[model samples]
Target: MRDFNRYRHKGAFCLMKYAAEDGSEVEWIWNSRDGVTPFCVSNRTGDKMLQHVDWHLDRRIFDYQPMPCERIFVDLSPDRARQRAERTIEHYWNRDDCAHIRQLFGTKEKAIEGLLAESRVGEAPDLVEFGSLEPGAYRR
Candidate 1:
Protein backbone atom coordinates (compact mmCIF):
# COMPACT_ATOMS: atom_id res chain seq x y z
CA MET A 1 0.00 0.00 0.00
CA ARG A 2 1.44 3.33 -1.08
CA ASP A 3 0.98 6.11 1.46
CA PHE A 4 0.84 8.76 -1.28
CA ASN A 5 0.22 11.88 0.78
CA ARG A 6 -0.98 14.70 -1.47
CA TYR A 7 -0.62 17.37 1.18
CA ARG A 8 3.06 16.57 1.41
CA HIS A 9 3.89 17.47 -2.16
CA LYS A 10 6.99 19.08 -3.69
CA GLY A 11 5.78 22.71 -3.59
CA ALA A 12 3.32 25.03 -1.88
CA PHE A 13 0.07 23.11 -1.44
CA CYS A 14 -3.20 24.27 0.09
CA LEU A 15 -6.68 22.86 0.45
CA MET A 16 -8.81 24.95 -1.88
CA LYS A 17 -12.48 24.77 -2.80
CA TYR A 18 -13.19 24.39 -6.51
CA ALA A 19 -16.43 24.47 -8.51
CA ALA A 20 -16.77 21.52 -10.82
CA GLU A 21 -18.51 21.31 -14.19
CA ASP A 22 -21.46 19.52 -12.60
CA GLY A 23 -22.32 22.53 -10.42
CA SER A 24 -21.11 20.65 -7.37
CA GLU A 25 -18.79 22.35 -4.97
CA VAL A 26 -16.05 19.91 -4.05
CA GLU A 27 -13.03 20.39 -1.86
CA TRP A 28 -9.95 20.00 -4.04
CA ILE A 29 -6.51 20.33 -2.59
CA TRP A 30 -4.37 22.06 -5.20
CA ASN A 31 -1.07 23.93 -5.04
CA SER A 32 -1.43 26.25 -8.00
CA ARG A 33 -1.25 29.95 -7.20
CA ASP A 34 -4.13 32.24 -8.20
CA GLY A 35 -2.94 33.51 -11.59
CA VAL A 36 -1.08 30.51 -13.01
CA THR A 37 -3.10 27.98 -15.06
CA PRO A 38 -2.34 24.33 -14.60
CA PHE A 39 -1.96 21.75 -17.30
CA CYS A 40 -4.27 19.45 -15.40
CA VAL A 41 -5.66 19.48 -11.92
CA SER A 42 -6.92 16.46 -10.03
CA ASN A 43 -8.34 15.78 -6.62
CA ARG A 44 -6.12 15.42 -3.59
CA THR A 45 -6.03 11.72 -4.30
CA GLY A 46 -3.84 11.67 -7.39
CA ASP A 47 -5.29 8.48 -8.72
CA LYS A 48 -5.77 8.10 -12.47
CA MET A 49 -7.55 4.98 -13.65
CA LEU A 50 -8.06 4.20 -17.38
CA GLN A 51 -9.07 7.63 -18.63
CA HIS A 52 -7.37 7.68 -22.04
CA VAL A 53 -6.19 5.44 -24.89
CA ASP A 54 -3.78 5.37 -27.82
CA TRP A 55 -3.31 3.21 -30.96
CA HIS A 56 0.08 1.77 -31.89
CA LEU A 57 1.32 -0.39 -34.75
CA ASP A 58 -1.46 -2.98 -35.12
CA ARG A 59 -2.09 -2.67 -31.40
CA ARG A 60 -4.13 -0.46 -29.12
CA ILE A 61 -2.40 1.04 -26.12
CA PHE A 62 -4.61 2.01 -23.20
CA ASP A 63 -3.44 4.92 -21.14
CA TYR A 64 -4.10 4.67 -17.43
CA GLN A 65 -1.42 7.24 -16.80
CA PRO A 66 -1.49 9.45 -13.77
CA MET A 67 -2.03 12.86 -15.24
CA PRO A 68 0.01 15.72 -13.85
CA CYS A 69 -2.36 17.38 -11.45
CA GLU A 70 -1.14 20.95 -10.95
CA ARG A 71 2.45 20.30 -9.93
CA ILE A 72 2.43 23.33 -7.67
CA PHE A 73 2.94 21.84 -4.27
CA VAL A 74 5.90 23.84 -3.02
CA ASP A 75 8.53 21.44 -1.75
CA LEU A 76 7.35 21.05 1.81
CA SER A 77 10.73 21.45 3.42
CA PRO A 78 11.42 23.30 6.64
CA ASP A 79 13.14 26.12 4.77
CA ARG A 80 10.30 26.41 2.27
CA ALA A 81 7.75 26.41 5.04
CA ARG A 82 9.67 29.17 6.73
CA GLN A 83 9.70 31.14 3.51
CA ARG A 84 5.95 30.71 3.23
CA ALA A 85 5.59 31.92 6.78
CA GLU A 86 7.55 35.08 5.98
CA ARG A 87 5.39 35.73 2.95
CA THR A 88 2.22 35.26 4.95
CA ILE A 89 3.43 37.61 7.66
CA GLU A 90 4.48 40.22 5.12
CA HIS A 91 1.07 40.06 3.44
CA TYR A 92 -0.74 40.66 6.72
CA TRP A 93 1.72 43.26 7.84
CA ASN A 94 1.32 45.26 4.64
CA ARG A 95 -2.48 45.34 4.85
CA ASP A 96 -2.54 46.06 8.56
CA ASP A 97 -2.88 49.76 9.44
CA CYS A 98 -3.84 49.89 13.08
CA ALA A 99 -1.83 53.08 13.86
CA HIS A 100 -0.62 51.67 17.15
CA ILE A 101 1.29 48.85 15.48
CA ARG A 102 2.69 51.29 12.95
CA GLN A 103 4.67 53.01 15.72
CA LEU A 104 6.52 49.75 16.37
CA PHE A 105 7.56 49.67 12.72
CA GLY A 106 8.03 53.28 11.80
CA THR A 107 9.41 53.38 8.25
CA LYS A 108 11.24 50.14 8.86
CA GLU A 109 10.34 47.01 6.89
CA LYS A 110 13.24 45.27 8.58
CA ALA A 111 11.37 45.42 11.89
CA ILE A 112 8.54 43.38 10.43
CA GLU A 113 10.97 41.03 8.70
CA GLY A 114 12.87 40.42 11.89
CA LEU A 115 9.67 39.74 13.77
CA LEU A 116 8.59 37.24 11.14
CA ALA A 117 12.00 35.59 11.18
CA GLU A 118 11.62 34.89 14.89
CA SER A 119 8.34 33.12 14.29
CA ARG A 120 7.42 29.84 12.61
CA VAL A 121 5.08 29.20 9.76
CA GLY A 122 1.35 29.77 10.53
CA GLU A 123 2.24 30.99 13.99
CA ALA A 124 2.81 34.64 14.75
CA PRO A 125 2.35 36.91 17.69
CA ASP A 126 -0.94 38.71 17.27
CA LEU A 127 -0.52 42.46 17.12
CA VAL A 128 -4.04 42.88 18.40
CA GLU A 129 -3.27 40.72 21.37
CA PHE A 130 -0.26 42.93 22.07
CA GLY A 131 -2.72 45.78 22.84
CA SER A 132 -1.77 47.53 19.64
CA LEU A 133 -5.35 48.15 18.64
CA GLU A 134 -8.84 48.10 20.05
CA PRO A 135 -11.24 45.22 19.51
CA GLY A 136 -14.25 45.48 17.17
CA ALA A 137 -12.34 47.86 14.94
CA TYR A 138 -13.32 46.07 11.76
CA ARG A 139 -16.06 43.55 11.10
CA ARG A 140 -16.64 41.40 8.09
Candidate 2:
Protein backbone atom coordinates (compact mmCIF):
# COMPACT_ATOMS: atom_id res chain seq x y z
CA MET A 1 0.00 0.00 0.00
CA ARG A 2 2.99 2.33 -0.53
CA ASP A 3 2.86 5.17 -2.99
CA PHE A 4 5.05 7.92 -4.48
CA ASN A 5 3.41 10.49 -6.71
CA ARG A 6 4.72 13.59 -8.47
CA TYR A 7 4.87 15.34 -11.80
CA ARG A 8 7.84 15.19 -14.17
CA HIS A 9 8.92 17.21 -17.20
CA LYS A 10 6.54 19.89 -15.98
CA GLY A 11 3.50 17.61 -15.73
CA ALA A 12 4.28 15.87 -18.99
CA PHE A 13 5.45 12.53 -17.65
CA CYS A 14 3.06 10.90 -15.21
CA LEU A 15 3.89 7.36 -14.13
CA MET A 16 2.21 5.00 -11.70
CA LYS A 17 3.33 1.78 -10.06
CA TYR A 18 1.47 -1.07 -8.44
CA ALA A 19 2.36 -4.08 -6.34
CA ALA A 20 0.68 -7.45 -6.69
CA GLU A 21 0.94 -10.81 -5.09
CA ASP A 22 0.27 -14.15 -6.76
CA GLY A 23 0.44 -17.32 -4.65
CA SER A 24 3.98 -17.30 -3.20
CA GLU A 25 5.54 -14.64 -5.48
CA VAL A 26 5.42 -10.86 -5.41
CA GLU A 27 5.44 -8.46 -8.33
CA TRP A 28 5.81 -4.75 -9.00
CA ILE A 29 4.36 -2.80 -11.92
CA TRP A 30 5.13 0.56 -13.41
CA ASN A 31 4.01 2.48 -16.47
CA SER A 32 6.42 4.78 -18.30
CA ARG A 33 5.98 7.71 -20.69
CA ASP A 34 2.95 9.22 -19.01
CA GLY A 35 1.20 5.89 -18.74
CA VAL A 36 0.75 5.80 -22.51
CA THR A 37 2.98 2.77 -22.95
CA PRO A 38 1.19 -0.48 -23.68
CA PHE A 39 3.13 -2.57 -21.18
CA CYS A 40 4.13 -2.06 -17.57
CA VAL A 41 7.54 -2.80 -16.12
CA SER A 42 7.17 -5.52 -13.50
CA ASN A 43 9.76 -6.87 -11.14
CA ARG A 44 9.62 -7.21 -7.36
CA THR A 45 11.18 -3.72 -7.27
CA GLY A 46 13.91 -5.30 -5.10
CA ASP A 47 13.81 -8.62 -6.91
CA LYS A 48 14.36 -8.74 -10.70
CA MET A 49 11.82 -6.47 -12.30
CA LEU A 50 14.61 -4.00 -12.93
CA GLN A 51 16.91 -6.81 -13.97
CA HIS A 52 14.29 -8.41 -16.21
CA VAL A 53 14.06 -5.05 -17.96
CA ASP A 54 17.81 -5.08 -18.28
CA TRP A 55 18.80 -6.83 -21.52
CA HIS A 56 22.23 -7.92 -20.28
CA LEU A 57 21.07 -10.05 -17.35
CA ASP A 58 21.61 -13.80 -17.69
CA ARG A 59 21.26 -15.07 -14.11
CA ARG A 60 18.92 -17.96 -13.42
CA ILE A 61 17.33 -19.22 -10.19
CA PHE A 62 13.73 -20.32 -9.94
CA ASP A 63 12.75 -23.57 -11.70
CA TYR A 64 9.50 -22.45 -13.33
CA GLN A 65 9.29 -19.12 -15.16
CA PRO A 66 6.91 -16.67 -13.57
CA MET A 67 5.33 -13.59 -15.05
CA PRO A 68 6.68 -10.56 -13.25
CA CYS A 69 3.76 -8.22 -13.87
CA GLU A 70 0.37 -8.28 -15.46
CA ARG A 71 -1.22 -5.51 -17.41
CA ILE A 72 -4.17 -4.06 -15.52
CA PHE A 73 -7.43 -4.50 -17.37
CA VAL A 74 -8.33 -1.11 -18.79
CA ASP A 75 -12.03 -0.51 -18.26
CA LEU A 76 -12.24 2.68 -20.31
CA SER A 77 -13.50 2.09 -23.83
CA PRO A 78 -10.63 2.38 -26.32
CA ASP A 79 -12.44 4.76 -28.65
CA ARG A 80 -13.49 7.01 -25.78
CA ALA A 81 -10.03 6.82 -24.24
CA ARG A 82 -8.45 7.77 -27.54
CA GLN A 83 -10.78 10.71 -27.92
CA ARG A 84 -9.98 11.86 -24.38
CA ALA A 85 -6.26 11.59 -25.01
CA GLU A 86 -6.65 13.57 -28.20
CA ARG A 87 -8.65 16.22 -26.40
CA THR A 88 -6.02 16.46 -23.70
CA ILE A 89 -3.30 16.94 -26.31
CA GLU A 90 -5.37 19.55 -28.04
CA HIS A 91 -6.01 21.38 -24.77
CA TYR A 92 -2.34 21.62 -23.99
CA TRP A 93 -1.47 22.50 -27.55
CA ASN A 94 -3.89 25.40 -27.64
CA ARG A 95 -2.84 26.72 -24.24
CA ASP A 96 0.79 26.81 -25.37
CA ASP A 97 1.63 24.57 -22.43
CA CYS A 98 3.07 21.84 -24.61
CA ALA A 99 6.46 22.81 -25.98
CA HIS A 100 6.58 19.68 -28.10
CA ILE A 101 3.73 21.18 -30.09
CA ARG A 102 4.89 23.41 -32.96
CA GLN A 103 2.47 26.30 -32.34
CA LEU A 104 3.37 28.89 -29.71
CA PHE A 105 1.07 30.71 -27.28
CA GLY A 106 1.29 34.27 -26.05
CA THR A 107 -0.69 36.43 -23.69
CA LYS A 108 -2.62 39.37 -25.07
CA GLU A 109 0.10 41.78 -23.95
CA LYS A 110 2.81 39.53 -25.35
CA ALA A 111 1.00 39.14 -28.65
CA ILE A 112 0.65 42.89 -28.94
CA GLU A 113 4.30 43.35 -28.14
CA GLY A 114 5.26 40.80 -30.74
CA LEU A 115 3.06 42.49 -33.29
CA LEU A 116 4.67 45.81 -32.42
CA ALA A 117 8.10 44.33 -32.91
CA GLU A 118 7.09 42.92 -36.27
CA SER A 119 5.54 46.20 -37.26
CA ARG A 120 8.79 47.96 -36.41
CA VAL A 121 10.45 45.76 -38.99
CA GLY A 122 7.71 46.51 -41.53
CA GLU A 123 5.32 43.99 -43.05
CA ALA A 124 7.07 40.89 -44.26
CA PRO A 125 6.95 40.23 -47.99
CA ASP A 126 4.60 37.44 -48.99
CA LEU A 127 7.02 35.78 -51.39
CA VAL A 128 10.74 35.86 -52.11
CA GLU A 129 12.91 34.50 -54.92
CA PHE A 130 15.47 31.80 -54.22
CA GLY A 131 19.21 32.67 -54.14
CA SER A 132 18.30 36.34 -54.26
CA LEU A 133 21.03 38.55 -52.88
CA GLU A 134 18.56 40.95 -51.28
CA PRO A 135 14.98 40.84 -50.08
CA GLY A 136 12.22 42.51 -52.24
CA ALA A 137 14.94 43.06 -54.87
CA TYR A 138 13.58 40.09 -56.83
CA ARG A 139 9.94 39.03 -57.06
CA ARG A 140 8.39 35.71 -58.08
Candidate 3:
Protein backbone atom coordinates (compact mmCIF):
# COMPACT_ATOMS: atom_id res chain seq x y z
CA MET A 1 0.00 0.00 0.00
CA ARG A 2 1.28 3.50 -0.77
CA ASP A 3 1.86 5.92 2.08
CA PHE A 4 -1.39 7.90 2.27
CA ASN A 5 0.02 10.54 4.61
CA ARG A 6 1.82 12.29 1.75
CA TYR A 7 -1.46 12.57 -0.15
CA ARG A 8 -3.75 13.74 2.70
CA HIS A 9 -2.85 17.38 2.68
CA LYS A 10 -5.43 20.15 2.37
CA GLY A 11 -6.17 21.06 -1.23
CA ALA A 12 -3.91 18.29 -2.52
CA PHE A 13 -4.48 16.53 -5.81
CA CYS A 14 -4.01 12.77 -5.72
CA LEU A 15 -4.18 10.51 -8.75
CA MET A 16 -4.32 6.83 -7.87
CA LYS A 17 -4.25 3.90 -10.26
CA TYR A 18 -5.52 0.45 -9.54
CA ALA A 19 -5.83 -2.92 -11.26
CA ALA A 20 -9.10 -4.66 -10.62
CA GLU A 21 -9.36 -8.37 -9.95
CA ASP A 22 -11.08 -8.75 -13.32
CA GLY A 23 -8.11 -7.30 -15.24
CA SER A 24 -9.36 -3.76 -15.58
CA GLU A 25 -7.52 -0.49 -14.99
CA VAL A 26 -9.08 2.05 -12.66
CA GLU A 27 -8.08 5.65 -12.20
CA TRP A 28 -9.19 7.66 -9.23
CA ILE A 29 -8.56 11.37 -8.80
CA TRP A 30 -8.96 12.96 -5.37
CA ASN A 31 -9.22 16.67 -4.79
CA SER A 32 -10.06 18.02 -1.37
CA ARG A 33 -12.45 20.63 -2.73
CA ASP A 34 -13.80 18.61 -5.61
CA GLY A 35 -13.93 15.16 -3.96
CA VAL A 36 -13.15 11.87 -5.75
CA THR A 37 -13.98 10.65 -9.23
CA PRO A 38 -13.26 7.18 -10.61
CA PHE A 39 -12.67 6.14 -14.22
CA CYS A 40 -12.48 2.55 -15.33
CA VAL A 41 -10.76 1.22 -18.47
CA SER A 42 -11.91 -2.22 -19.34
CA ASN A 43 -9.53 -4.82 -20.70
CA ARG A 44 -12.23 -7.17 -22.01
CA THR A 45 -13.61 -6.12 -25.35
CA GLY A 46 -16.97 -4.30 -25.29
CA ASP A 47 -17.05 -4.34 -21.47
CA LYS A 48 -17.19 -0.88 -19.97
CA MET A 49 -17.91 -0.05 -16.34
CA LEU A 50 -18.32 3.59 -15.46
CA GLN A 51 -20.05 4.62 -12.25
CA HIS A 52 -19.79 6.90 -9.25
CA VAL A 53 -17.89 5.44 -6.35
CA ASP A 54 -18.33 6.77 -2.83
CA TRP A 55 -15.15 7.46 -0.86
CA HIS A 56 -14.31 9.39 2.24
CA LEU A 57 -11.30 10.63 4.15
CA ASP A 58 -10.89 8.46 7.20
CA ARG A 59 -9.93 10.78 10.03
CA ARG A 60 -8.92 7.99 12.39
CA ILE A 61 -6.34 6.57 9.97
CA PHE A 62 -5.60 9.93 8.39
CA ASP A 63 -5.96 8.43 4.93
CA TYR A 64 -8.49 8.03 2.18
CA GLN A 65 -10.00 4.56 2.09
CA PRO A 66 -11.77 3.64 -1.10
CA MET A 67 -13.69 0.43 -1.76
CA PRO A 68 -11.50 -2.60 -1.00
CA CYS A 69 -8.86 -2.80 -3.75
CA GLU A 70 -5.11 -2.72 -4.23
CA ARG A 71 -3.58 0.54 -5.36
CA ILE A 72 -0.95 0.40 -8.07
CA PHE A 73 0.35 3.99 -8.01
CA VAL A 74 -0.33 7.24 -6.25
CA ASP A 75 0.67 10.68 -7.54
CA LEU A 76 0.22 13.53 -5.12
CA SER A 77 0.47 17.13 -6.28
CA PRO A 78 -0.80 20.42 -4.87
CA ASP A 79 -0.33 23.04 -7.58
CA ARG A 80 -3.28 22.13 -9.77
CA ALA A 81 -5.54 21.40 -6.82
CA ARG A 82 -4.83 24.76 -5.26
CA GLN A 83 -5.46 26.54 -8.54
CA ARG A 84 -8.77 24.76 -9.09
CA ALA A 85 -9.90 25.35 -5.52
CA GLU A 86 -9.30 29.05 -5.92
CA ARG A 87 -11.57 29.16 -8.95
CA THR A 88 -14.38 27.13 -7.37
CA ILE A 89 -17.19 28.80 -5.48
CA GLU A 90 -19.14 27.35 -2.57
CA HIS A 91 -22.53 28.12 -1.08
CA TYR A 92 -23.16 28.32 2.65
CA TRP A 93 -26.69 27.41 3.64
CA ASN A 94 -28.56 27.45 6.91
CA ARG A 95 -30.57 24.32 7.59
CA ASP A 96 -34.02 25.63 8.35
CA ASP A 97 -37.49 25.38 6.97
CA CYS A 98 -36.54 27.10 3.75
CA ALA A 99 -32.81 26.23 3.73
CA HIS A 100 -31.80 29.79 3.04
CA ILE A 101 -28.41 30.44 1.48
CA ARG A 102 -26.45 32.72 3.75
CA GLN A 103 -23.41 33.58 1.71
CA LEU A 104 -20.83 32.43 -0.81
CA PHE A 105 -17.39 31.15 0.05
CA GLY A 106 -14.29 30.18 -1.86
CA THR A 107 -13.73 26.99 0.13
CA LYS A 108 -15.51 24.63 2.49
CA GLU A 109 -13.36 25.66 5.41
CA LYS A 110 -14.27 29.27 4.86
CA ALA A 111 -17.95 28.36 4.75
CA ILE A 112 -17.66 26.46 8.01
CA GLU A 113 -15.84 29.35 9.59
CA GLY A 114 -18.52 31.76 8.44
CA LEU A 115 -21.20 29.52 9.85
CA LEU A 116 -19.38 29.21 13.14
CA ALA A 117 -19.01 32.96 13.38
CA GLU A 118 -22.65 33.50 12.65
CA SER A 119 -23.65 30.90 15.17
CA ARG A 120 -21.54 32.59 17.82
CA VAL A 121 -23.39 35.83 17.15
CA GLY A 122 -26.75 34.04 17.19
CA GLU A 123 -27.32 35.03 13.56
CA ALA A 124 -27.23 31.52 12.13
CA PRO A 125 -28.74 28.32 13.45
CA ASP A 126 -26.72 25.35 14.54
CA LEU A 127 -27.57 23.25 11.50
CA VAL A 128 -25.49 24.70 8.68
CA GLU A 129 -24.00 23.10 5.61
CA PHE A 130 -22.16 23.98 2.44
CA GLY A 131 -22.09 22.81 -1.17
CA SER A 132 -19.90 23.64 -4.15
CA LEU A 133 -21.03 25.17 -7.44
CA GLU A 134 -19.55 26.85 -10.46
CA PRO A 135 -18.66 30.49 -10.47
CA GLY A 136 -21.59 32.80 -11.35
CA ALA A 137 -24.01 29.95 -10.66
CA TYR A 138 -25.79 31.88 -7.94
CA ARG A 139 -26.36 34.83 -10.23
CA ARG A 140 -28.58 32.83 -12.53
**Clash count of each predicted structure:** 7, 1, 0
Best by TM-score: 1
Model 2 lDDT vs. the true structure?
0.30
Evaluate model 1: give its TM-score.
0.27
Candidate 3 ranges beyond 4 A from true positions: 1-49, 52-74, 90-140
Q: Which candidate is the best by lDDT?
A: 1
C-alpha TM-score for every candidate: 0.27, 0.20, 0.19
Error of 1 at 88 (Å): 6.4
Q: Where is the poorest 10-residue window by lDDT in model 3? A: 122-131
lDDT of 1 by residue, 2-64 (tens): 222432323222333343445433433333211222323443454421111111211111211
- Quantify all predictions' global Cα lDDT against the true fold: 0.34, 0.30, 0.33
RMSD each, Å: 17.9, 22.1, 15.3
Q: Give the number of colliding residue pairs in candidate 1.
A: 7
Arranged by lDDT with the best first, the candidates are 1, 3, 2
lDDT of 1 at 12: 22
